[model samples]
Target: MSGHGFHVHGPHDHAVEHAAHGSDKFSGNIAVMTAILATVGAMFGYQGGATQNDAALFKNNAAIDKTEAANRWNYYQAKSNKQNLAELAMTLPGADAERYKADVARYKTEKDGIKKDAEKWEASSAEWNQKSDAAMHQHHQWALATTAEQIAISLAAITLLTHKKWLQYTAYGVAAAGIGLGAFAWLHVDPIGALALKLGMGAAGH
Candidate 1:
């Protein structure tokens, strides 16, 4: 889902070596493998789409919370200015001195409540940030999984073309990795995301 907003781009292009179908060394076997790959590939693709959608939803929610927090802080600042003004007005010598002092006390109490509300909104924003990060991490996992699936499908085609046992085994290995990555995404295990974060931080230092 990554480069821009909520919509996800398609998976990367895979270089598959297709074999000619008419009895060209186990074409029937190739057909079966292709069918199986098609099914699994569809499932992985759907999961990737779902992951991207979830990530977008979280990002949107985080934006909402951030905006609300900003508004709350603005309100807090207005209240603070009012409290300061009331305090300053209390210094004037008049029959209204007591009234100005009362206003000062009221403003101070109202400012305290505003401060709490601002802090609560800030905390809410932080929570939303965490959620958005988590969703993005899951999206990365799904992207990796989908890439692996594509590679596996390519390898399966190449295996049929060359009839190499090792190549078939490698295809299976890639497919297993795809399944594992998909599980990581769904389970919210964040090894790949953590590694990316670490690498990004390291690069920024340079």
Candidate 2:
């Protein structure tokens, strides 16, 4: 009978291999989490930027409407004041009474036309205000939704980094809640709603 010597590798190598495998698994998990976070962040950023641009546009439109309204009002007021002054001058027993009367007639004609135009602009101003307000409100809602989504995504990323399962689940739940809220806001306050308000206001001559 011949006996063969048996040798076994030490446990150190096995322990090292186990640790290496565990590290690889952890790295893979982190990579997946990072990719998800990046994708969500990008989406939120895009929506946020769009909302901001829309808000700016609405503000600019409102400003323009207000300026036009003011100008129209001022023109009417100036015309009225000038007509009054001309009448007062005519009564002053001055050498240029005939000239004053002619000036008064001219002013009256010009003022009548300006009055009609002012009324039209006033109606337009009211319509514009309604439309701009609606648009601004919609943009604000979109901004809020984007902000909520951003917060949820950030929380999820933090949970993933810390390997907190419960926290991660909570983060997902919050994200779902945010999505629902965003949907509700969009439904209630949208650009279509703004456009409809504008059309209705115009038809009503507001």
Candidate 3:
């Protein structure tokens, strides 16, 4: 994971120049290591893409729910205004008290219905918010997986450049870490709760 692959051997290092880059065995081994890294990179890349798609979909849903909730509140406000007008009319003199009373009663009934609808919308918005948070958690998991895989690939590159078998072994360790991250992403297991942090772009109930 570090950029320290250019380590230089001491004075006698050139003694092994006979087995330099032209050796078939060395080339073959480096090629194989590269191939393995490529395979793992591709798999993790696909997983990252799919995770992004899901996050986008959840964000869209959250937006829609929040908009609907706002609309319901607006409707509730309109009903309240009408109710206020009706009550004011009832306070005014003689325009047929019965008609004013009837209007007031009608407005009150409408307000009750509007109140219930507004409350329902609010509840629905909250549910959508919870769903969005869960999706975001998964998105973070995928991000972690992708990061690990990228580091592993870099390590593999160093392995090829330095022709150090130990570097390749270190690459394997990094690759295993990447695989572990992928497994955690797939299983939705974030023991540290770090994945719960919001990306702020796709949050619901905003």
Candidate 4:
């Protein structure tokens, strides 16, 4: 058959080869990106979860303080009632009149101390409630920002996978996400989580 002097392989072969190479590269890139994303996501999720726990713990502590204050106040009231009964008993003409008076005096002293302690605990509980609220607010903000940043990273990663030519844009997006995550970790999670983790480690060691 008469044909062009330059004999070449079919164009389809080259196209297929090119596509195969591109697919391999894309697959490798996807694996690497998935690993990175998973790691970052876990870190972010753990931080968010820990902060939520801290907020819960703070709330629980505040509740405990309030319960303690209430108990102390109840104890004071009961002691005051007992003191009044002792004073009544002291008025009776009996050999134990002096002992009854002494008992009443003791009850009065204990009731006074309990009243002061209850007041202190009341004030302390109020302060703890305020602190717990502030911690909850801070944790909520951190969780929100971290969640947004993770979403942005995931979206950017998907965009990059779809459009390889936009690799540069994805790099910038990744850097921004990293910065945001670092800031969130440092400000919110690190402080509280580190302490809890340390205590956990200590307990585990034992």
- Top candidate, metric TM-score: 1
Give TM-scores for every candidate, taking all chains together and pairing residue i with residue i. Answer: 0.77, 0.56, 0.71, 0.56
lDDT for each residue of candidate 1 in 21-80, tens digit (9 for 90 to 100) = 245656455556656665667777787777678767877777787787788778878877
- lDDT by residue for model 3 over 11-50, one digit each (tens)? 1122223234456676455556555656666777787777
Please provide, for model 2 over 94-202, each residue's C-alpha lDDT reduced to its tens digit, 9 standing for 90 to 100: 4588888898898889888877877776677677666666655655665666566566655655554576777667766766665665575557646556789999999
lDDT of candidate model 2 versus the reference: 0.63
lDDT of 4 by residue, 1-206 (tens): 34757656332233333344665665455445544544555566676677677777877887888899999999998998898888888888765888988998899889889999988888888887777766666666556555554554454455434655465355447646555645755564455566899999999999
Question: lDDT at 7 for candidate 3?
Answer: 68
Q: How does model 3 fare in lDDT? A: 0.69
Q: Which ten residues in a row have the lowest lDDT in candidate 4?
A: 9-18
> Pairing residues by index, what is the TM-score of model 1?
0.77
Give the C-alpha miss distance for residue 112 in model 4, angstroms. Answer: 2.4
lDDT of 1 at 7: 61
Model 2: residues with Cα > 4 Å off, grouped in runs: 1-41, 89-106, 122-132, 161-163, 190-206
Stretches of model 4 off by over 4 angstroms after superposition: 1-37, 85-104, 120-131, 161-178, 181-185, 188-206
At residue 128, candidate 2 shows an lDDT of 61
lDDT of each: 0.72, 0.63, 0.69, 0.65
Q: Is candidate 1 or candidate 4 better by TM-score?
A: 1
Best-performing candidate as measured by lDDT: 1
User: What's the best-to-worst order under lDDT?
Assistant: 1, 3, 4, 2
By the lDDT metric, which is better: model 1 or model 3? Answer: 1
